[model samples]
Target: MEQQPTADPRGAIETVFRIESPRIIAGVTRIVRDVGIAEELAQDALVAALEQWPRDGVPDNPGAWLMATAKHRAIDLVRRRERYARKLEEVGRDLSLSTPHHVDEPADPDAIDDDLLRLVFTACHPVLSAEARIALTLRLLGGLTTPEIARAYLAPEPTIAQRIVRAKRTLATRGVAFEVPYGPEREARLGSVLEVIYLIFNEGYAATAGDDLLRPALCEDALRLARVLAELMPKESEVHGLVALLELQSSRAAARTGPSGEPVLLKDQNRSRWNRLLIRRGFAALARANAVSTGVPGPYALQAAIAACHAQAYAYEDTDWHQIATLYGLLVTRSPSPVIELNRAVAVSMADGPEPALAIVDTLATEPALRDYHLLPSVRGDLLARLGRTAEARAEFERAALLARNARERALLEERAVGLDRPAAEGPAGTAAVRCGRAGPRSGGQ
Candidate 1:
C-alpha cells in the first residue's frame, strides 16, 4: 500500500533529496560515466518527485524511489548517445534499469557501496586543483548547494559556481576513471581524499575569515564523510585515525564559544559541556587505529593520540602535557611540517616552561612557511608575557591581531594586547592571560 501523502510534500522531497542525493548521483554516475550529467539527472529526479509524490502519495522508501528514477534517466541518456553500443558494453552489467514493482526496491548494497567509493575517489582526484576538489566534493558528496558552500568559505557564489563547473569538465575531458585505485597509486590518492576531508573540517572547526568562529554544518558534513569512509574501508588504519581525530575535536564544539559567540580559549572552556558520547567514540576509533598499526603510527593517528590526551584530562591543570609534547614530537617526525612544529611548541610550553618553549618558537620565526602565520606571533606573545616582557608581548599581540582574519580571533588578540596597559595589581596574571592559539593540533585558522 502507498504511504499517506506528506502534508508538506515539498519539504519532505527536499529533506529526502538532501539525504539521498549523493547516493543517487553516485549510482547515476556509474551508468552515465559523467558526474556533471549525473548531477543534472539527480535534479531531474527531484523535479519528478515534486510533481508526482504529492498526487500519488509518498512512497514507503522515498530514497529508493528517487534513486530508481535517476538511474532510469541515466540509462536512457546513455542509450541515446552515438556510442551507445560501446558505452552499453562498458556498463552492461549495471544497466538493469527495468522498472521495479514497488518503484522503491533498493539497489545491491555492495554495488552501491562501490559506486560511492568510486565517487569519493573521482571527486578528490589529483587532476583537479585543491579548491576545485573541495568545491566539487562538497557539492556531490556533501549534498551542499553552491550558495551554501560559498557562504561557508566566504567566497563569491559565481567563483564557486565556475570552479565546480570547470572541475566537472576537467574530469570528463581528461577521462579520469571512476574507480578506486590499487597499491601505491591507491595510497597516494587516499592521501588526497583524506586531506580534502581534513581541510573541510578545519575550515568549519575554525573559520579562516568570518563573523562566526565556527561553522557547525561544515564540521557535521566533514565528520559524516569521514565516518562513511571509515566504514567503507574498515581495515585502513589511517581512515580510523582521521575519524578518531575528527570525533575527539568535534566533542568540544559546545564549549568552544561563549554565550555571546566569542572564542573560548582551551584553559577557560567548561569541560562538562563536551560531548561524552563523541569522546568515547573517538577513543574506540583511536584504539582501532593503534591495533591495526604495523609500524609507527601515521600522522593522523599521532594527532588523534594528542587529542585523546586532552580528552583524558578532566581539568586544564590535570592535562598530561609531557605525553602531549611527546606525541607532537612523534607527529613532527611523521609529518615534518612547520605548522606541526608550531603546535609542538604550544604543548612544550605547558609541559616544560615558557622559556624553553620560547626558544623553540624563536627557531621557527625565520622559517619561510611561518613568516605570515598569525599563530607564530600569537604563541610568541603568550611566551613573552609569561617571561615578564610586557612591551614586546603587547607588540606581538597587536601584530597578531592585524594578521588575523576572523573577527572573533582578531578581537581576542586585540583584547590581550590592550590588557597589558592595566596596572600590575589590576591585571590578571600573565600566565592566566595567555591564549594557547588553537585548543588542539591543526584545529585553528592559519
Candidate 2:
C-alpha cells in the first residue's frame, strides 16, 4: 500500500477522487460486470487508500493505484461467491479453484472510451426515466455524491438516494448495455441525455434554494461533461450546441453575483466581467451549429444566440433590445412557454415600453404555470415601476419578495418595495450593490 504525500493526504485524496473516480468506476464495472457492485468495489478501494496512503507515501501514479485497488476488490467479490467459477468462465478465465486469485487480463486504456461512453449511455437510458437517469449519471459519472445530487435538485437526501437505487436496479434487471445508441433510437436517447446536462447547468447557474445564487462546481462539472461528449460525438450538431450554451453561460458567472453574493440583473451587471475567451468559443460553436443544417435553430442554438447578443454588447446602454426581442419572438413561436413569453415581455419592455410588456404579463396572470413563479411578478413589478405606477409596483415588489425563496433575492425585492415609498439611496443608476450589508460589485474579487 502506498502512502499519500505530505501535502494533506486527505485533500489529495479528495482531489484525486473527484478527477479519477469516474474512470475508476467505469474500468471497475468492466471487470465486475455489474455497475452497482462495481461502485461498491470502487468505494472500498477509496476506503483502502484513506487508511494506507497516509503511512506509505503517495504512489507515482495515484490513478493507477486506485484502479489496482478496485481490481483487488473485484477479485475478492468473485472468489467469495459460489458462482465464482462460472464468473471466471464468463470472463474467459480458467475455473480451477486452485488457481491464483489474481485475474489474468491485459490493461487496455483505449477500451476505456467505449466503456465510459457505455456507462454514460446506460445511466442516461430512457428506461430509468428522465430524473432518475440524471441523478444516476451525475452520481456515477459526474463525480457527485448523493448529497450533492440532492442539493443540486433541491430534493431531500433520502429521495435522491432512493431514486439512484431504483435507477441502478432497473438497469441491472433490464440488462441495459453500457453502449451508445445507433440511428433513431440513438438520436432519441441522446436528446434526453442532452436535456439532463442542460438542466444541470441551469440549476447551477441559478440555484433554486440556499443562500448562494450560484454553484460554480455544478456548472463547471456539466460544462466539462458536455465538452467531452461533444468530442466523443463530434458529428452531432446538438452536442456542440449544448457545449456552446454552457461555456457561454458559464462565462457570465463571474458577473452574476455581487461582492456579497447578491444577484446582478443582466442589464445592470458589468460587461467587463464577462470572459471574452468563452464568448468567442460560443460564437464559433453557434456558427458550427448553423452550418450543420438549414433547419430552424434548435433550442440550445437559439438560446446561444440570445446569450451572444448580451456577450457582444460592450455596455448595458448599447444592447440591441430590439434584436433580442425579435429573437425571443422566434423562440416563443418555436418553443412556446410561459417562461419564454415572460422573458420576451422583458425584452419588449426594454424595446417598446412597460405598457405592452405589462399586457403580455397580464395575459399570463391566469396561467397555471406562472401562478407561483416569482419572476413573473418581479418582471411585472419592474415594468410597472418603469411606467410610474408606484402603488402597484410597490405591491408587486412585495408580492415577489414573498414568493422568492432565496434570502438575497427576497431582500433585494423587499428593498425595491421599500424604495418605492422612499427616495433612492445616493449612488449610480445600478441599485446599491449590497454585500454582507455593504455595497456594489466588488471588483477587488472578494
Candidate 3:
C-alpha cells in the first residue's frame, strides 16, 4: 500500500523520521558495524525521503521504508570500502542486500529486536564515560537532538555535541562489539545499561541544577527506553523491575509540583493527580519481574515494591511504612550504598520513630559519600525537626539549602529552615518531614 501524495511531505517525513530513526540506525549499524556511520546513513535516508516522498507519496510502512533506505546506504558504504564480500560472508544468509527489490520486503521483527538490543548495548558500553554514555544514548536511541539533550540537562550545546562525538569515537576506537554480552559480562553490562536509564530518569524527576524541578521529556525518553528494553529482553527480571520503578515514579509527576512549579512534598501532594494508568502498568511490570525471579528480588524490584506501598496508600497516613522499611532493608543487602542507607533511614523514621532514624543518619554523617550529598542533611533536618530540636533542625536545613544545586529544592529547604522559627500553628507541618520517603530511594545514582 502507498500513501496518496500530499502537496508537502516535509511534516510527514519529520514525524516518521523521529519515530523510526532509532530502528533505522540500529538496522544500518548491523551492516556498517559503526554506530556513528549508521546514524549518518539514517539521516541520509531521511534526506532521501524529504526529496522523494512529496513527488512519489509517503510509503504505507514509512518505518520500513526508512529502514530499508538506510540499510541500502549502509550496504553501499561497505561496498565502497571494499568489504562487501567479507561483510556478505559475515552476515551470511541474513544479508538481504543482494537485490534492490528486497527494500520492499518488510524486515524481520526478530532481527529488528536483536539489532535494537545491540544498539542499546553499544550506546551504553563501559568504555565511555557516564556522561558520554548518557549523551550518546539519548542521541542514538532516544532520537533526541543535541540541543534537546543539552536543554534537558542544562549543559552547553557544544559540550553535549563534543560528548557524543567523543563517545562514538571511543566506542569505535576501542572496537566494542555491537552484540549483547553473555554470562558474567552480560550481568555487568546490563547493570550499566540500567544505571544509564535510571540516571536519566532521576535527572528528570529531580533535576540537579535547573530552575525546573521536572524535565518531562527526559523522563518520557527514559520510560520509553525502559519499556523497549523490557520488550527486547523479556526474561531479564531487573529490566522489568527498572520499567516498573520508572512507571510508578512517573505516575506522581503531575502531583510533584505546585501550581507555580514549586516542589511539593509527598505529604502535601494531591494523590488525586496521580496517573492511575501508570501505577497499574507499574504493578503489572513489577509482577512480571517477581514472576520471573529465581532468587531474591534485585535492587530495582525492591525499590519498585517500596513505591507500590506508597501507591497503595490513598492518604499519606495510610502508607505502609513498615513494609517500605522492610523493602529498603532488603535493598541494602543487595545493593549497599550510603544513599540506600539514607533512604532506609527515612523509612525507618516513618515506621518506628525519628530518634532511631536520627541515630542512623548520625552514623552516616562520617561517611565521605554523604558529605556532599545535600539529601543527607535534608533528611537529618527533617528528623531533627520531628524530634523538636528546632534550632539544630534550622541549621541543618540551612546547610542543606546551601548544598542543594537545584534552585527549586534550595528554595524549599530554605523555607523549611525559616518555618522552624514560626509558631507551631503557622509552621510548615508534615511537608518537609516526609520528603525523603515520598521521593523513594535515590538508588539509581541521584
State each model's C-alpha RMSD to the native: 7.1, 7.8, 7.5
lDDT of 1 by residue, 156-187 (tens): 88999999999999999999888877766766
Model 3 residue 6 CA deviation in Å = 28
Q: Which candidate wins on TM-score?
A: 2
Indicate the residue-level lDDT of 359 in model 2. Answer: 95
Q: What is the C-alpha lDDT of each candidate?
A: 0.77, 0.69, 0.77
Off by over 4 Å in 1: 1-119, 126-169, 177-188, 423-446
Model 2, CA-based lDDT: 0.69
By the TM-score metric, which is better: model 1 or model 2? 2
Show pairs that collide, candidate 3: none
TM-score of each: 0.68, 0.70, 0.67
Can you write out model 2's per-residue Cα lDDT over 1-446, one digit (the tens) per residue? 33335655887776677667767788777666677888888888888878866776666666667776786667678888766676666654311222212223334545655566667777887788887888887777666678666644546779899999999898888887766777777777887678666765665666545577776765765676677777767777778877777777777888888899987766577878889999898888878877775688876777677777767779777677788788878877876777677777777777787789789989989987456566667777777777778899888889978876667778778888888767643212222221100010111011
The lDDT-based order of candidates, best leading, equals 1, 3, 2
Task: TM-score for candidate 3, please give it.
Answer: 0.67
Which runs of model 2 end up more than 4 angstroms from their true locations? 1-119, 129-166, 181-185, 422-446
lDDT for 411 in candidate 3 is 92
For model 3, the superposed segments whose C-alpha errors exceed 4 Å read: 1-119, 126-169, 177-188, 424-446
**Model 3 agreement with the true structure over 1-41: per-residue lDDT tens digits:** 54588898898898788767777888888888899988999
